[model samples]
Target: MTTDHIGDVTKAFIDYVDHNALHAVAPENVLIEAFLNATAAEAAEVLAHLEDDDIERHLPRVIVHLIRRLAAAHKNPTPDAVAYEAQNPNLGIANQPSHLRIVKYITDVYTSQIKGDLWSVAERVAADAYTRRVGEDCERLAQIALTNVTAAELEHHIKTNVERWRDHGKRLRRITNHDNAPTNLKAVA
Candidate 1:
């Protein structure tokens, strides 16, 4: 599906956090750092080791593992971390795994699908509309994770996204002829 707008909005949200949040100043923040350093190529390299069918099923787990290892290695340097650092010296994490690169790759893949681009227009609109709402919440979570926030608070924050998603559909319907979008979109009118 054509998700170019989706990627554009997603990048906007990330840029907002990177530019405005406390994490922007704190390079030591592992979550943000890993995200900033992650690339599609790294994710592709990890997938090269996996069977095609397993890629989607195991991608999230691989990302989590890479992040956790990143944090672990940063907290306590090890030989494996050194080896990984050699490969991804910019990451400043121990045992830099190619799996780490897959994090951002998830969004890139969304924008690459051509067959269903028309169907995804509403999604892109929704994303563009709600970028700041989502970005602020994410920034808040990242900031609080470094200090204080209850599990219940965290759960509430996460649950709010579901409602926002619903709202996106509603807004798209109100704002545009999303349901009847042309089957084949062209850049020029």
Candidate 2:
């Protein structure tokens, strides 16, 4: 996607958070900073605006989904792909064992079957096998390719995100007075 598209998506995400009051639920600055410095405050602001229940249930899933999507988009072959190339005769020779080179070889195999663009049926099948065998290992590695994040980083992320949410809860209680609301107002109001 273009930079403009990414920016637009980011803006829309922020707007969604604001509209939902996620910031009131989960101030996300620290967690956001952990992901990307530019989106830190904006992400926190968005998280702060969500409902507590919604934030608890959905935020982690959203983050994981985003990570997975990014990972898939930038995914290249892994060491397994190199091994596959080494074993396969029709794939020819590969002097180096680099991930990109292996991925290219896989892509060539994929493209050959389609008779069109460089797509990889073999790679897809292998990916499926990897998913079954490694149980998200390839996907995790793929996500790592998209960002410099690590499992240890994610542990920090969990802690920060939780703290932000808790802080938002405290702030929300201090900011709102339920008893002072007009009696005539509906519960949904």
Candidate 3:
């Protein structure tokens, strides 16, 4: 959530790379400036670091490490974390749509519900829980969209929630216009 954590993550990445035998072609090796600046023996240093397997087994390890970091990084961010400075975790959190936000909020709670938090096992349980939540939420939102809010109901709700009332007005108003929307707005439920 904090920019300070980037250095730790960078160190983590470097440590993982240093320990594992990924056949990495360092960025310096790609450019002509690197070739021209370096001595002939510099290439030897590069060769020494690279893992020389025909299969390049370490490549998969690098991918797994990336995924692991991502999973680790996906720790739930608070609303205020992104307010001052825009960064990762923040970007990841900010970009999620409201529909997904509803599902994620519910699923995240379900995941963290039992005995504090277990990241791995929680994900599995949350997956099952999320599926059901999404389905139910989708059906409910669909039903809500179809149903018209009575004028008195809208007025009463607007006192508490003007923005939400406006959104409902927009949704209903669209369906009310025969030229704009083909489907009828009225619903029994």
Task: Report the number of clashing residue pairs per model.
Answer: 4, 16, 0
User: What tens-digit string does per-residue lDDT give for candidate 2 at 93-127?
Assistant: 22334445444433433332223111121122223
**Ranking of candidates on TM-score, top first:** 1, 2, 3
Superior by TM-score: candidate 1 or candidate 3: 1
TM-score of each: 0.26, 0.19, 0.18
- Cα lDDT, all candidates: 0.42, 0.36, 0.33
The residue ranges of model 3 lying beyond 4 angstroms of the native Cα positions read: 1-118, 150-189
- Pairs in clash, predicted candidate 1: 1-116, 1-117, 2-117, 81-95
lDDT of 1 by residue, 1-189 (tens): 459988999999999866545422221222223332434343232222222221122433344344345544443222234235335445443434463455343333322222232223333433444664566668877786676788888778777876865665565544344323453345666
lDDT of 3 by residue, 23-129 (tens): 22222112111212223343222222222211122322222222223334442222122111122333333233343343342233323313221222222222333
Q: Which candidate model has the greater lDDT, 2 or 3?
A: 2
Which is the leading candidate under lDDT?
1
Q: What lDDT score is found at residue 104 in candidate 2? A: 49
